[model samples]
Every structure is written in C-alpha cells, then in structure tokens.
Target: MKKLVLSLFIVLFVFGTSLSQIRPVYAAENDFTFTVGSNGATVTDYKGTDLNVVIPAAYAGTTVTEIGRSAFDTYGTGKPKITSVVIPSSVKVIQTYGFRYTSLTSIDLPDSLLTIGSSAFENNPLTYVEFPDSVTMIGNYSFYMNNLTSIKLSENLKTINGGAFDTNHITKLVIPAGVTKVDSSSFYNNNLTSITVLGNATTFGTGVFAGNPGNLKIFGIANSPVYAYASSNGHTFVDGTVLFQAVVSAKSLLNSHLAGTGVGQVPANTYNDLSAAYHAAMIFVDGIGNATIASDLDNAAIPLTSAISAFNAEIIKAGNPAALVAAITAAQQAMTNHPQGVNVGQTSAANRSTLQNAITAAQQIFNQAGQYLQGELDVAVAQLEMAIDTFEDVIITAGNPTALGAAITAAQQALTDHPAGVNVGQASVGTRTALQTASNAAQQILDNAGNYTQDQLDAAVNQLNTAVQVFNAAVIQAGIPTALGAAISVAQQALTDHPEGTDVGQASAGTRTALQTASNSAQQILDNASNYTQNQLD
Candidate 1:
C-alpha cells in the first residue's frame, strides 16, 4: 500500500509539471503584458506610449515568439503614440491588431517573421518597409491605411489576404515571384501608379484592384496569368515586346514625315521649332530601353505622345503643296524685287565666286524639287541668269585702263617691223589693206588715250588689242623677206602667247622693249629687201 501511494504522487507531480507549461495568460514581470507558451513568451499589450517602440527580443529569460492580438492597439481610448517599431528577429508571428491605430511612421520587421495576422499593421503612417524573405503569409487588412510610399514584398511570400494594403500611399509596387494567391481588395484604394507582377499567380481574387486609378499600368510577362488577369479586368497590360515596337514605330513615322523638302525651306525660326519638337519626341523613344510597355509608358509615354502630336501638326503644315509653293515663290520674288546691287568692275572676285556658287546651289535645289516647285525654280533661275549677264557687262567697262597703253605700243612695233608699204612681196592686196586699217585705228586710240576716261580707256584697250592682233596676222600671211620675217614672227608669237597688258605684273618693261626692237629691225630689213637680188635675200 505504501509503494502504490508514492507511485500516484509521482504521476500527479509529472502531470502538474506538464500543465504548468500551458500558461494561457501569465503576465510576465516586464514592461509588456505577456503570456507564456511552450516555445517562449508572447507580448499581449504595450503598457507605455513611447513614440518609438522597440519590442524586447526576450521576456523573463524566454525568447518572444509572437505579438498577441491588439498588443499595440490604442486600448479603445485613442491611437497609440508609437511612431516607429523595431521588431526583434526572435518574434516569428505578429498577431491581429499588433500595430493597429498606432502613429507609427516606420518599422523594420525582422527576417525571422513567418506570419502576419489580420489587421496587424492597420492604420499606421509607415513611409517605407521591407518585408523579409522568410515571411510566407500576409493576413487580411495587414497594412491597410498606411502612408507607405514604397513597400517591398518578400520574395518567398505566397499569400496576401483581403485588404492587405488597402488605402495606402504607395506609388509603385512589385509583387514577388513566389506569390501564388492574392485575395480580393489586396491593393484596394491605394495611390498606386504602377504594379509589376513577377509571379504568375494561380488565384487572383475579385476586386483585387478595384479602387486604383484608371490610368494605372499593369506589368507582367506577355502570356503570364497576371497579364491575362489585367486583360480580363480591362487594365492596360504592358510587356517588353509591345513597348519596344510601339515606341520605335512612332519614332520612325515621325522622322520620315519630317524629312520632306519643305522642312528646310521654312523660315529659320520655324524650322528650329520643328526640329526641337522632333528631338523632344525622340528623347522619349530613347528612354524605352529594355523596359516593359508599362514601364516605358510610365516614364515617357505622355510626353512623347504630346511631342509627336506637335510634330505631326508642324509637318502637315510644312508639307502642304500649296503652302510650299507660296513660300518658294515668295522667296524668289523677294530676291527679284530686292536684288543685291552689283558694283560692276569694282566687284571683288570673291563676290563673283559667291554668285556662281549660289546659282549652282539653286540649280541643284530646283533639279531635286517636285513638279509643284519647278515653276518657282524656273523663275529664280531666270533672275539669276539676268544678274550674271549684268555683272559680266559691268565687269569689262569698269576694269583699269592701263591695258590700253600696252596694246598701242604693241601695234606701233608691229607697224615699224613689217610696214605694209615696204612689204610688196607675195602678200595679197586685201591682206595689206587690212593691216593699214588696223594700224590707223590703233594710232587714233593711242593719240587720245590720255583724254579717255578710265572706263573709256578700258574699252579703247580692248579695241586696240583686237586691231594689233589683226595686223600681226596680215603680216604673217604677206610673207615678209626672210630676215624681217624671222624677227617679226618672234615678236608676234610672244604677243600671242602672252596677250598685251595681261598679267603685266610678271612681264618687265625690258622684255617688252626687246620684243619691239626685234620688230623694228625686221621692218628695216623688209624696207631694204626689195632692192636685194634673190641670192642676197637667201
């Protein structure tokens, strides 16, 4: 009997010890309310209202494994004063109402967290939070009513329950690849500009994106479930291939239309405006590097669209056949009505070269122009021809008159060397008469050279040079005696090769005098050759 009683006592003691491990509500001797469990402790309430709260990793020598329901709530009085929370890695679960109605603006949930219960973070003011990869489940209304601008979902996260992020301030959200299901209202009523899904979720609940802006872009692989979801729900689906093709096609069209001939013929300011518009559109096209359709549109679509529109308008105006014709004709008329004054002989060689180039360029443009512009091109060409003729005529009369003196000198030498009166050898009477007429004309101009104006002297020089050239030709044909012919031929050939008074800077006065002396001796031989016998002439 004594042995049996001791065994029962031992059994009761072991049972009591097992029961002690299950403390449903044991308030630990700490700043927080807690309950002891088999694994560790759970925080039940935050007694203090510190704006920045740091939950203890351990309570009463035991690691805290969870935050109990409503632990950080306002206790039905008002919102908690907590503005931020630092959760230790030891806590694996955040129960319902863990941080609800707190004034928390930021939180760093440790990577040890595995589950976040319903309404765990509802009504906070968090600006940025990164959920660690170990997290697998986000309960209903977990982050509802936050002020989150950026939130990173865990890569290992599998489920986001209803209203998980409802009524937040997120601008951009990227759903992780491991996500399999997103409950209804998961992203409801947020200021989300874009949502990119890296995962092909199997279950997308109704009203998953009910309250977002209409202009929000949904991004995913082209044939992925997320893309199908977006399409079925009438959301704008964006993919890489579509984005590249759309932007490139738009850019190409704009460039081709703007490359028309009329684009350059516009006024300088107008052309600059058109070019700038085209460049702006191209900038948007350049921004579309390896991006999905949603991403490309998010950054550059609107601006590019506006730029393209403006470009189209400008191109249309420029390409108007009637308008182009008017512009071209107006330019031609302007040149004709306000022709640049050419100062004739005073015009520099540079100016002449410029005029020549202008004509060539205009002809090129005319040749390349379509039929509509050719009429105006013809008019411009005619005006240019007139300008050229006027310029040439003035060029001759306006040149320096010093050339006339050289011409007269050459003529006098020719007469003295092979006088027509002395040279009666086999020359024709007509040839002799031509030489006399030429010499007299040259003499008359030389006599009055000083009295002539510079312009008149220039004309006289041209006339005298012609006369001298004629007389030289007649002498050659007349065949003077051998002695006179050789000298005369030398002088005549020199004058022909280097025309009288041309390039005078290179010819010395001594060279000219030598030539004249040869001619004078030649004439003396001719004057006496008639009296010599054939043997003496030979």
Candidate 2:
C-alpha cells in the first residue's frame, strides 16, 4: 500500500507541473478577455457596458499586441454599447471582424497599428478615418458600410483587400506611393468623385471603383497601372504631376501683379478674385482641406488662370499721348493751309468744314486725362489724316477766259453780217437764232470768268465757234433767184397736168388751186428781185 501511494503522488505531481506550464485560453481582466501568446496578449473579447471603451495597453501583466477576431463585434458575448474607442499604442494588428457591427462613430487608430484584418471595423457609423503611416495592409471590407466622407490613407500602405472601403460616403481618396495592390471592389459603391494614386507600380483588381460616380477622376502617372485601370474602367485619368504644375503656374501668374489704382497695377477687386483662386488652389497642392481631389485642383486652377487674365486686362497702363498730340497738330496745320472760300483757286467751303470737324474730334480725344485706349487714339489719328488728304484733293485753280471771249466776239460779228431777212446774202432766220443763243451763253461765262473751271470755259468757246460756222454756211447767196424761177416753172406745169374738177390720181381741186397760187407768188418775187427779200422769194 505505501508503494501505490508513492506512484500516485508522482503522477499527480507530474500533472500539476504540466498544468502550470500551459497558458489559459482566455483570462478576464477588468472588462477585457484576452489570450496570452509568446509575444504578447491579444484582446479576444470585451464584456463591458461602456459607451466609450479604452482597451488597456497591458492586460494580465503582458502587453496587448492585437485585438482578436470578433472581439467587440455585434455577435460577441459582451455586445457593449460602444460609440467611441481609444486603442492603445501596444496594439499592432486588428484581426478579422475585430470591431465589426459596432456603434462606433469615432475611433482613434494608434500609430503602432500595422495590419487591419478583414471587416475589422465594418458596419460602423464612422464619418471620418485616418490610418497611421505605420499601417501597411487593410483587409477585405475593413471599413465597409460606413458614413465616411473623407479618409487619409497611410503612406506605408501596401495592400487593400476586396470591398475594403465599399458602401461609404467617401467623396475623395488618395492612395499613397507605397501602395502595391488594390483588390476587386475595394472602393465600390461610394460617392467618390476624385481619387489620386501616387504610385506608378500599383496594380488594381476588377471593379475596384465599380458603382462609384461615372464622372470619377483618377489621377496618377501618365502610363502607370492606375492610369491603365482608369482607362479600362471608363474613368477619367488626370496626371497628378501635371496638375500640380498647373497649380504652381497659376499661382505664379497671380502673384506677378499688385492691387492698386496706380499705373501697371490691377484693380483691387480683380486682385482679390485672383488671390482667392490662388489660395484655394494651394489647398489641393498642399493636400489639405476639402479640396484634396484631382478635380478640385483642376477646378481651382481654371478659375485662377481666368482671374489672372482678368486682372491683367484691368491693369492700368500709361498711354503715351505724344503720337496723338502730334497727329492733332498736323491736322490743324492742314486746315490752316487750305482756307475756306468760294473764290477762284481756293478750297471749297464744304471741304474746309469737314477738315475742321475732324480736327475738333481728335483734339477732344487728346484732351482726355490719360484714360483713353491707344486704339481709340489711333482711330482718331487715322480719321484726321484722311480728312487732311481729302481737303487737298478739292482745291480749285484759275481758268483762262480769253478764248471764250474771242469766240463770243466772232459769233456776234457773224450774226451782224447774216441778218435774219429775205435779202440776198443774208442768213436764214433759224440759223441767225442759233448763233444768237450760243453768243449769249458765251458772253455770260465771260462776264463771270472766275466762277467757272477751265474745262467749262473751253467747252463754251467750242460751242460758239460751231454755231458761227453753221450760220455762215446757211447764208442767202446770189444764185437763189435763178433756182426760184426754175422751181416756179415746175409748179405751173404740175398745175396744168392735174386740172381742178378732174379726178386725177395726183391732185384734187383744192390742191391744184394752192399750187397755182404758190407758182404765181414765186413768179412775181423772181421778176421783182429788187423789192422781195431772199426769205420771201424762197
């Protein structure tokens, strides 16, 4: 019996030693249920009713290194009413579903956090989130179904799993240069308008931004993976480097002007508008404020450039009045050179009036106190110069009246020699009348010789000379008596052939009587040539 007791004692002692070496599956300390590992403790569950939970950095004498899967989830045993959480810096990893389906509106992610497991903070009411630079990986659906409108991703992030930020209110996002892989549907079904990917080597999975805005702009390097992905998915891709350059250029353009009313300065209102646009663009350049998107930068740059252009246009420039003043002086000198008068060899009153009007307008423009546009002054100068040239074209010169006076004298002598009557060698009444009319017109031109031009006086002289030649050609001559006697004989014979009362085809009784009477009168005139005039005999 004493040998059996000794063996049982040995077995019991061995069992106690084994139990002492083994670690507990979970140990409850304060409100946390954690598991101790070789490295540190991991919070496995929370059994608290606190609305604000602060996970201890050290639990059960070991540093808490992680938050275990489903530790504070809706399905967890405690189901605490957590609205906010303060994670300790001792935490490095948050396992899958660590804080899923919680009422968390705010959470402080510690800088020491390295990995976020799948659906770790899913179905929360988080409106904003910022991952620390130490975080490298984000698991699937990690921040799904949240109220987040903006998020700042960790610079060291390398991977983003499927549906990690799906179904949120995020409008803008920036994927840092260290990011390598973004899984399918990683940012799906959100309100994203702009996303900037800084890395050129990052690869994208299918539907990464599916169901987001159709006008979503993705910014990246020109030929990088993000650019390719955006092209294949029908999203607009903007080059971030180019956008930044544009912003810088716009800022530089705006700063080149000063705000004042002095020369070479822009108006105060114009400068203010440009300054506002520049400052707004700087927000995107510096990656702060709500203007953190690529579209924001684009929108800001356009207005800034427009404002700069407007400012430049409104700048007060000093206009040189020397050219305009010289033009005015030259125009006035032209007016003095061509005086207004109706006398011979002088400029017409109408031309002088036009020149004076042009000079008046130009002088008015030059009198303005340095507020006129150069174009306006140039137009005035052109008009005044044209007026001066036109005035010179209309000057009247002296015309000779001696030729017209001689023509009138010769025509009058012809009328005196060929008097209108029946006398032999005298002009016919019609020819004398023509010569008299032409002589009267030429005499009137000679009386006011200075009023008519040289061409007009020459035309009058030619007309009077033609009339005199016609009068002399049509004068009564010595052979008229013989011609009249022959004509009377012929008429008498015509009367004898067609007698009165006979129905001959040539003449009736009245026509025969008239011919006999005319023949008798011609015979009487031809016989008594001393008493009858040439017109009467004919």
Candidate 3:
C-alpha cells in the first residue's frame, strides 16, 4: 500500500512538472501578424513587409513575444515610426532583413541574445550603441544606414557581416585589433575624416571606399603594408590615424576631471584650457618606436615640462647627468611646458595597430560564414520562385471558382519553398484581389441555388460554401501547426539546396489569402466548422 501511494505521488509530481513546462507563450496573433513561429525563447510573428517591432520585456496580458514581422511594414509609405524600444534578452535570433526600414530612434538589447539575424535592424535611426561582450556574430547589414555618431563594440565580437553600418555618421573610427575584415562598404558613404587601424590590417576588398573623399585621413599599423590601395584614391596617410571621438556633444560633458594619482597629487580642473593646449601637443607628435621624447605635447606647458624632466634626465644620466637632470626637474615643477599628458599624449598613447588586426580577423570570420551560406541562398531563392508558380497553376486549373479549395495546397507549398529568414513581400506573392474575386464569384454561384433540384443544388452550393469556409478557416488557421507544417516543408526543401548558403524562410501574403479562401469554402459546405464556436463558425 505504501509503495503504491508513493508511486502515485511520483506520477502526479511528474505530471505537474510537465504542465508547468508547457506554459503558453502569448503573442499579438493574426490580427496584426501573418506568420508566428517558434524561435529560441520569444515566439516571433511576421506580418509587415519589412518587419518593424517594439519588443517589450514584459507585458501585463500580452505575451512578451508580441512583436510581429511586417507589423510595422509602412506598405510603401516608408518605415514604421517609433520613439524608443527596449528589447528583451530572451530574444536570441532576430531573423534576416528584420526591421529593415523602420524609423526607430534607439534600441537596447539584453544579454541573453546570442545571434542577431542578417540584415536585422538595417535602416534604423539609432545614434548610439554599446554591444555587450557576449555577442560574437553580427549579421549582414545589422547596423547599416544608422545615425550613429559613436559606438563601442564588444571585445569578443568574432565576425561582422558585409555592409555593417555602411552609411553611419561617425567622423572618426577606431576599429579594434581583433576584427579581421573591415568588409566592403562596411563604412562606406560615411563622414569619416580619420581612421586609425590597431594592428596588421589586411584583406581589404575592392573599392572599399569607392566614392569617399580622396582627402580622407587613414592611419594604420606601423610598417603595416595593408591598405596600400588607399593611396590610389589619394587618401591622406597618417601612421596611426584612427581615433575614438566621443559621440556625445560637449554640452552634455562635465567640465571637471579628477587629476593626479599619487599621495601628494591634487585634483585639478583638467578640462580647462590649460589642459587643452597641453593635451593637444601630446597627440600631435608621432613618437612611436623611439626612446627619445618625441610627442605632440611640445605645445603644452605641463606635459612639456614632464617630458623634459623625464626624457632629458635619462639622456643626461648617461652623459652630463647631475646638473642637467636637476635643471629639468626644476623646470617641470615650475610648469615650464603645458603637461603633455593632457594633449597629444592622450591620443598618441593608444596603439592603433592592435585594433586594426582585430577588425580584420572579425571581418574574415564573417566572410567565411557568408561563404558557407551562399549555396543555400541560391537553392532557396529558386524554390521560392517555383512555389509561387505551382500555386498559380492550382488557381488556374481550378477554373470553377467554387473548386478553388485546391489553391490552399499550392500556397502552402509556396511558403514552404522558403521558410525562415525570408520575407513574403509584394515581389514574392500572387494577387490577393484575384483570390477575393474568385471567392466572391463562388459565393454568387451558391446564392443562385433556386435554378437546380434540391439535393443537387444543395450539394453543389454546400460544397462551394464549405470550400469558402475552409479557405477562410485556413487564413484563420494559418497559425495552427498542421497548416504551417506543409508550408514550412517547402521552405525546408529550399534549405537543403543551399547547403553552403544561409537558411532562409518566407511566407507569402497571396498564398495566405488563398488558404483562407479554401478554409472558408470548406466551412460553408460542412454547415459548421469543428475548430470554431458558433460565433466564429458563421
């Protein structure tokens, strides 16, 4: 008896745990979206042409995964407009071309996300971004055409896809040392005035800066042979050129800075003019690879004094040590030279070579990944085209508008041709108006029931009506796994063709309407729908 009781208790416990795991994931369903699918964490919905979404980390009644694709499509009016958005970390895969043309000012991503899909958030109005260290793969065109004046990338980022932030607002650039390729058009058409590479920057593609000003300044690793092609455009050459400029305007900056690190050191108004001139000179001098005191700090009083005291002393000690060293130390104490550390020293101290090498590596990795996905893309594109063709055939073959139920299968196949990472825009779809016209015609045929015998007329009209209901139900039932399964199959087949290219999936709006028509037809023929209640079955 005791054993049986314990066994029953264990079964109940397991059942409770299973139920807990099956919690519902809510989303703003079909009212605004066309396709909602299972992603890693947050369920994703696609509806708008170019998906625009505002992902709220939490919603009271709505599931946090409520942002739908094409939910903000703008439908030729342009992108959807939004003030700001806070993306949840739970979102791992943001699909390809997602948020392509939206008017969002800013976005903040959470840590849980690992992959940001290709071309995701391509043309947003984001001005500033600070990527988390956890992000490794940055998809193609992820930040292209943004209004970013400044950005701080994560150190561990491995790959950056093509056209990443192509037309940004940054004036100066300091690409890190870990990145490999600074991909083609990655920084094209920007207001870039200065660029300094950190390390051995190699493998730059053709016309990387095709139309930019020839006078643009470029700085790279010392003795680093990369970017020799830059000279072809008459680009200005600086040994270590790129510098990280603050994105924020001076008005937002505090006027004060703590100075002096030792016990006797005192905090000074380091942001004042006194520090300005000193800091300027420190950066002006290209003093790398030399033991001598060559620095931009010659114009700064404090820095010049410090340099004289330090450099001259070292030289003096090896020669006329005693008197010269004492004189230099005294001069520094009197603030004879504007402190060099405040001026040119600040800029020159940074090693541009190391950062450049990093940027190169990251780019290389991204290109490699792209290479892997190329073949996949080719097959997927072809399959998508075929799916559309097949669907059109079905619609044409069913000459009798009342028999339009078969179009649903063709449309489903069309969607399957290219599943995820694809968009069902106007270009890839058939005409919804045709389907609607057919639907109307079929209904008209049913309405003219008095011309035939009771059973014959009823059978014809009932089947026609059922076909219409089925079509309608299909559009409504597109969310159901059964209907979506057939659609995804075509897309998965496309994926196999592109074993080398990236995986992409698409859902067509035209096909969606056709399926809805079939569902509506089926419902009318049956006189009732099993899935919907009386209020909906009608």
Candidate 4:
C-alpha cells in the first residue's frame, strides 16, 4: 500500500493537479491512491512559486513521468511552513536544484525514487534519509547541509554521484559493497563513527572522505580492491600504502629548484610527479609553495586545480565547504609555515618541542656530492664503500658479479661524469693536478679488474668495507681495498696449489701484478676526497 501510494502520487504530480506551482513531497505523508488512471494531465511549471501544493493521484487521468528543475529551491523560506506535499512514483526524473534550499525539516523519499539530480536538497532541514538500491545516484550537493543524524546506502546501489552527501550531520553510515567509490565528504561533518567501505570498493578521491565525521576513520573493506582509485588526483593506489614520505621528498627536491642552482641528482621518488601539475595546486600547504613548482603542476597531464577540486569535494562532502576549507587551510598553513619543509604536518607544542631535540642528531649526506666529483680521495673511498655495501646486500642472494660490477661502475661515474673539476672541497694547483692523474688510473684498473682472480674481488670487498669506518685504524693506515694486495697473495697461492695447471699460474701472476699497481692508485683517490672534509674541519 505504501509503495503503491508513492507511485501513483508522483505520477499525478508531474502531469499536475497544481494548476499553478509545484512543491516537494511532504514529510512522511502520502495521502492519495497508487494508480493514476490518465487524464491528459494538468499543466503546471515547477519553479519555486508554489506554497501548500498537492497533486491528486488520478490527476486529469495521466500518470506523471517527470519532475521539473528548481521544483523547490528556496521553497518555504522565512516561515515555519512546508505544510504538506505528495509525490507519485510515476515521476522518474528529478531535475537540478529540485526541492533544495527549502524549509523542509523532514521528508520520506519513496522507495520508487530512481534518480535525484544535483543540488536537490542542499540547505534543507531533512533529518534522515534512506536510499533505495533502486536509486542510482544522488547528484553533487543534493543532500549537502541537511541535518540528518545518519544515513544507510542501499545495497543494490552501484553509483552515488559526487558530493552526494557533503555537510550532513549523520552520526553513522554503512556503505554498501556495490559502491565503487565514496566521493569526497559524502559524510563531511557528520557524527559518523567510521565508514565501512564494502565489497570491491577501491579508490577514495582526494578530499573525498576528509572531515566527514570528526571521528570517522577509513578502514579497508574486506576484499576491497587492492589498488583503489583516487578520484581527485585520479591515481590508482594500493590500500594502506604510505605516500607522505614520497610527497614530502619530492617537495624537498623541488625546494632545491627554488634556490635556482645546485639542484643535484633527482631522487628516484620524484621522477613521475615532481612537475607543474603537482605544484600549481593552491594546496601549497604540502611544501609546493613557490610559483615555479606551481607552473610545473599547471603543465602536467593532471592539472593542480583538479586534484584540489577533487580533494575539496571530499572536504565539502564531510562538512560545509566554507567550514571545511577554513579547517584545512588552518591545518595546512600551520605546517608549511615552518622551515625546510621539515616536520611538515607536525603542528603543536608536542611536535615542536620533541622534534627539535630529536632532529639535531640527524646526519646530512650526499650533499657533499661536489666534494666527491672533485676526485677527493676521501669521497672516492666513501663512494666505493657505499657501492660495495649496496652490492653485498644484492650479491648475497643474487651472486651475480655482473650486477656487482654495474653497481661499481655507477659509483665511479658519480665522480667521472661530474662537470666541475672538484666537486668536494677547495682545490689548489696540486690537488687539481693530482685529481686528473688519479681519475685516469682508477678508470683503467676498474676497467681491467674483470679478469681479476677471486683473491682480488675478496680483497676489494674487504677494503671497501673497512673504509666506511672513519675512525678505523686499519683504514687510516694505507687506505682500504688498495692495502689488501690480494692479487699478489692469490697469484702466489695459485702457483703453489696448481703447479701443473699452466693456465692458473699464468692468469694469477698477470692479475696480481696489475692489482698491486691499481691498489696503490686507488689509495691516492681516497686521500684526495678526504681533503675537502679536512679543510672544512680546519
């Protein structure tokens, strides 16, 4: 009976019994019959002029098919009004601004409702809503500013359009598994405890779920898509993946560009988005503050405006846009206003006090790249140590000499390919001259070391490891890998162990002799790199 009544009433409402103006449905009231017989249907335009409107079920005999635009925008304002309304299920389409910004305190949407377009009930006083799986979408801001205590999405629903629930006052809600997304702020400032993302729902657009309920927390839906889509930035990401480090690191890389010089090797993490699109966003709250980064963000495939729009929508959906923006700006401003983009998101005394003390102990590395490029022997030694350490971790499992060799080559190139003569310290006439000789010798030895015996490889590895310990007495003496002299020892052993294998002794002897020379040369590069640090200390 209830279903039938709703169906027939809306049918007549569209065709009209209003003769003048039409209004939205009354709260929980469906007084007429279900079936509209079909008269040619009375003519009525549905702009905001109507007051206490009612549509008879069997209006002029035609079953109503559509509800017009702005059917109730500004309806019943300036009065304790909105006496009554009746809608028949025959009405299939509800247009934009329909029944929105009215004095409606409460209303029952019939189960027959299929579609409600954009801004339909924004600024209304509706306290509660129950979506029927039959309804496919609630357009952007359709229920924004409603005073609902809670909402429950219909299980059969496949799509809930963007901004469908921004700024509502719901305390709790359940998202049906069928929902592929929860557009920003669908529950913006409600009392929602948490949103239970269901089914295969994967993505949450930026700003989509932010500030929905102060207590609202996001949880992975069981069987939820591993990679969820970000509607704002449109990035498809795995759930629970950490991106703050990546975002901030990229910003730090961009920060170097601000100095307009000395921007070194790009961190691998910033290769993709350290561009115009990411920076152009007014969301400079995250360390992308300068105009240069903003221009870069503007030129990217995904514009900065859109990412923020998407995220803004999330904020709008949780609370009123005006309120959400203020809160977000406050939070963002507090973070970026600090120096170095360091501790970016850490606001408050607890963070300020604790972080200052802790960060003092942090060390800076790689910034001394120029010192290494200058062929400072210390820098070369350090580079070798780094390469070897990274290689051991790789070789222990993948025992591939080719891979280890490639790693070494990269380390060497860090110095050779450097544009400046000396990347590390103040160079005098002597060290500059020394640099060229050392570079040439080191390159030749590394190039020929492939034919080296196991003894040389082992010796090189040990030497590199010892070099990292700056205070190690062994490293301070004659330098590392160079001091090993593995080539000579291995060659002698080969001759003693394989007396008859002509190939073994011959190969060992040639390699050992070459290594002895190369070891002495490598020691010289180490001494050069260290000179810069010594100067700085002095």
Largest lDDT belongs to which candidate?
2
lDDT of 4 by residue, 71-188 (tens): 4555553322343455565565566876777677666566666777888778877887777667766777788888887665665666666677877776544555456655665555
Query: What clash pairs does model 2 have?
Result: 422-533, 422-534, 422-535, 423-534
TM-score against native, each model: 0.40, 0.42, 0.36, 0.33
- Winner by TM-score: 2
The whole-model lDDT of each prediction reads 0.66, 0.80, 0.46, 0.46
lDDT tens digits by residue: candidate 2, 341-411: 75555687788888888888878878882656566667777888788778777877658999998888888
| Candidate scoring better on lDDT of 2 and 3 | 2
Give the least accurate 10-residue stretch of model 3, judged by summed lDDT.
Answer: 243-252
Q: How many backbone clashes does candidate 3 have?
A: 107
Return the TM-score for candidate 2, rounded to 2 decimals.
0.42
RMSD of 1: 24.9
Over 1-538, each residue of candidate 1 has an lDDT whose tens digit, in order, gives: 9999999999999999999896433222355788899978998987764556677888778899999999888748564567667777899999998888888777888989999999998988888879999999999999998888778788689999999998887766777556899999998887765776655444688888878777777765577777788888888877733433334444455446545445433334434554564456444433332234555544544554455455555542312234334434544443443334443224445545555565665555555555324455556556665655554444423335457657766766766676544333333456546655765775675575544446666666677677666666655333337755666787777756664454753456677777777677667667777654444444
Instruction: Locate the minimum summed-lDDT window of 10 residues in model 2.
Output: 285-294
Q: Which window of ten consecutive residues has the lowest lDDT sum in model 1?
A: 316-325
lDDT of 4 at 225: 48
Which stretches of candidate 1 lie above 4 Å from their native place?
1-29, 75-80, 240-538
